[model samples]
Target: MACRVLEYLILPLVGAKTLIVGAKSVNYMKKNASTALRVRWSGSIRGGYSSNHGSRFYFTFDRAPCTGPAGIEAVDWTGASRNYHQHIEFEGLCNNIPAGHMQIGFNVGTLPGISWQPYLGWTTSGKPKITAEEVDLGENKGMCPHHTVFNVKQHTLATADTDSGIYGASAFRYTKLAPDTSLRVRWFGALGAKSQSPAPGCLRFYFTFNGEECKSPTPIDGAIAWLTDPIIQTRTTHSSQGDYAVALNVGQCLFGNLNQMDPDPHVNDVSRIIVEEVRLGKSQFAEQAVLLTCSFESSSICGFTQSTNDDFNWTRRSGGTSSSYTGPSSAYSGSYYMYIETSSPRVLGDTAVLYTPNLNLAGGCGRLVFRYHAYGSSLGYLRVKLYNGQHMTQQLWAYSGYSKNTWQETNVYFKQGGNFQIAFEGVRGRGVTGDIAIDAVAVFNVSSSYCNSPNRDLPKAAQQVFNLRHWNWYNLNFTGLGEIKSMIYPKISSTSGLRVSMTATVMTSQRLGPCTQWQFRFGGHVCPVPTHSVEGSRYTYSYQTTTQHLFPITVSGICTGLPAENLVLSIHTSSCGGSPAVDAVTGWQTSFFVSAEEVVLP
Candidate 1:
């Protein structure tokens, strides 16, 4: 999305002279002044002026035209209400405009409250300048349309329009009114026995032109009426007879073909329009229907394909096999489920994939809902993936650990086009407990409420705040002493006031001796010790450590920082007698993460 253009004009008046200050140039005028005085102040003036009480002068500040990319506009001037002392303050303007070459123009004049000439100076103030761009404000971004796809049942009129006084017979009939016209249907019906009691209802209209059905279904309301009650002849009440008039654009209904050729060439140039109706029924426009459902109840497998990288394969089971395979006895809804079981005692890095049939998700959101079981000590992971024919695959949902032996349901949504399919993948861990199962898989085509709406990308300002959860971890494993491992963060320009917090998960075969201490250092400074610990086994222990550090790092242009900018998360175990290993066969591993955010000081 493009940035909104902001235009501002600063008008300063001194006697009869008016000074117009814009983002690009300053216009100055002097009334009743001599040609000599006008010639002296006709051109541009640079630098500050000294106080001269005898001469009356008016000043204006204007920046030159910016020579950069498009969508760059001038700074918004907040007028002269911010005048402090004798200086007219122009602050909070756009940072993109060049400030170094700003020209200040002055015109001499005489007016009241101008007994003393004001001095001007351009210098940096104590407060920090805002260098943020306008696009960072997250305004004027893309928005989705409220209604894009709808499915409504058709409705028809009860009485013929020839005898009805409201509409003619031609209005109810599907006729070609014009070359670019739409299909319109209007109907009126009686609500009760009398015309005094009103009972309103709704009607839906569907159109088909040239053997092609319309995509959008529209609904209309009935007209109001007043009818006399049969129980009390004198009592007359307001009621509604479901009366509706619907118009469907021929071009949209016929899939962009306004002038559809008639199938019967012998007939006239007019094309036939078939109409259907469903009266007094609620609109099902927003309700989405289930496009695909799989219960895994039969041996046919419901047209689902299974794949595996290794020898392990997903098996169809109707009952539990053994104690290790203590999962759902049957499927969530049926008596069968697709499960992947690893060989007992030893677990291998095995993967089993089950994919759905090719689904048509063009111009709509596809919702995949399924139930999964992942419960065991050494349980593996269950991941749901979406594959688009364009060579793009997205991981929709993933579960790694146990789920209390109960079936858990999850929903994943994605927007796709062309040919697409959803795949259920089960990764086997290193033990017999690496068993997982899936059942009750369903896919739905949800109506798009906001189709083709404008969407804005995350602004550069918000990207400065680094979340530790978002950073990818770099693992290191070793015994005895460890080297200083450094990880460089992605660089960002035009920033200052740097602060960072580091987090890590350290799993060791054994704990370091009480006397022997280990420390994590970054930027030549020792980080804080581990504050949290989780005990897994007698020889295996997991420690979570966190530490914060402030650095004087200033970045401008495309400048990369010093060695200190590259954070080093290392364990100084050489000084201690004990050895702490990371991600080794001795059951040790370490994962490091850092959260670095920029602080803009005012």
Candidate 2:
């Protein structure tokens, strides 16, 4: 049982314990004695995850507060469709959680793309695993300051795993911490909630704070790492500053709140108190952890706590004025998703727009960020313009000329002075040559992309090539589109130059003009475009690249055009056959290699 202690009433005398009342928690620990006393309520990311994703949906334990929780665990996943899934054990303004809805996300990887597969539904009857809801725990209250919850996360990869290669992780899920807060710890449960009597074996893991401070290289001198399980994971012990690095764990703490005590939805953290995910395989093993956190000095009558929420707003913004987004897929009830026909080449000013709900900008600032793809040609462009939707106002941050179909990201921020309209505008080939796909769009009042995903890993391109050396391309019949799908690579590096290894598939000695382009950038300079050729169905290409910061890659440009005979003309860009300015073309290729170091150059 992953539990984040919401409120802790420490008394010098240990006779009485506190009790959960309707909207508040009573500290009876002092009963008739008269001494100093303290109580707290907090919550945190439990059960589900502490990161961002596009596949599995997330739920909120509903308790991320400095108050206490007052509910048991056990919920209904039905009716969760379209809106808040029943009464979540969460805190509201009056509860421990910070006002409205607060969340602490997590990442726990899983099968790349298996959830879509068919599954047989079943209804096996067994005794209630945990305690059932006695009543609507925190019914009439907005927040609960008397509940305890522990968040557990399970993450998954987006792209399907069809190839066999070591693909660097594109996501992070495990013990995550709020950047500003370092006093918290993460804990996991080895077994499901066995008996509430505190399972002795539950604490097999250890959370070594400041584990990144080892002067000598030793097994125990690194950042907080874990006992590698089905979820193969090492340790990364450094953040932006070298002071200390963050690590995952099996122990973490959270506070319970009064408003978040509704047992109906099974406080979002309850189910995730233990989780499993797919690191390289289909999912990480089921996980269980207890969270430990400290109390904050808020008002005299209250202490501090964490939140256990996983409610994200991937909700496609509306065509007009829109705000909050709910679950069950589809954008919010009032918004619309604009899918550009970028499916092909077109110059239609396609844009995706959304507005933040009327936030109290009078107090703080608002920001927006989202994932992007397709970064190569200077001709391909996506100008993300944030309109002040308030009309006459200025837009937020904007980026352009990223690429064609590669995946990447961009950010925009706005001050409290004006409202804004965030837009991803693609002027591809002047808005007519390629495609761009966007996911996980968000606007945070406090943090930026961080809120969109807590334990999220910045994405990296999975490079690969179809070269003759890897396979024989002559037997094209052996490998078709279906087989190509299985050729997905996590990464492909070549000292002699990477190329499509389709030997087992086909070989077309009958020179067929081959044409295709991968997205690339030159860090304000030009890149040594790689070269490729068709020796049958197997395409081969190679080139060396200069180290640069321009690798914010998006998608591999998938190009198909003209007739079979035209293949001859497609190989050489110098084969320029069109007019001067209108159809001007250049016969150039680029080559790239992973830089020796993944660090900012001095």
- Tens-digit lDDT track of model 2 for 1-602: 11121111211212112211121222222211111111111111112111111111121233322222322221112211111000011111112332222222211222242221111101110000100000111221221111111122322222212111111122243343222111212111111111112211111111232443211111111010110011111111221211232232322111111111111111122211112111121111100110111111112101111112211112222232121121112211112332223323234443333232333433235444455444333234445543444343553444555443433445444454444334444443443334343443444443233224333321111001111111111111221111121222211111112212110101111122221122222221112231212111111111211110000010111111110110111111111111111111111011111111010000
Q: How many residue pairs clash in each candidate?
A: 26, 157
- Give all candidate RMSDs, comma-separated: 32.5, 30.4
Highest lDDT: which candidate? Answer: 1
In candidate 1, residue 383 scores what lDDT?
84
Worst 10 residues of 2 by lDDT: 125-134
Residues 247-316, candidate 1: write the lDDT tens digits.
2211111122222211111101111111211111111122144557777777878888875444556788
Q: Which 10 successive residues of model 1 have the least lDDT summed?
A: 228-237
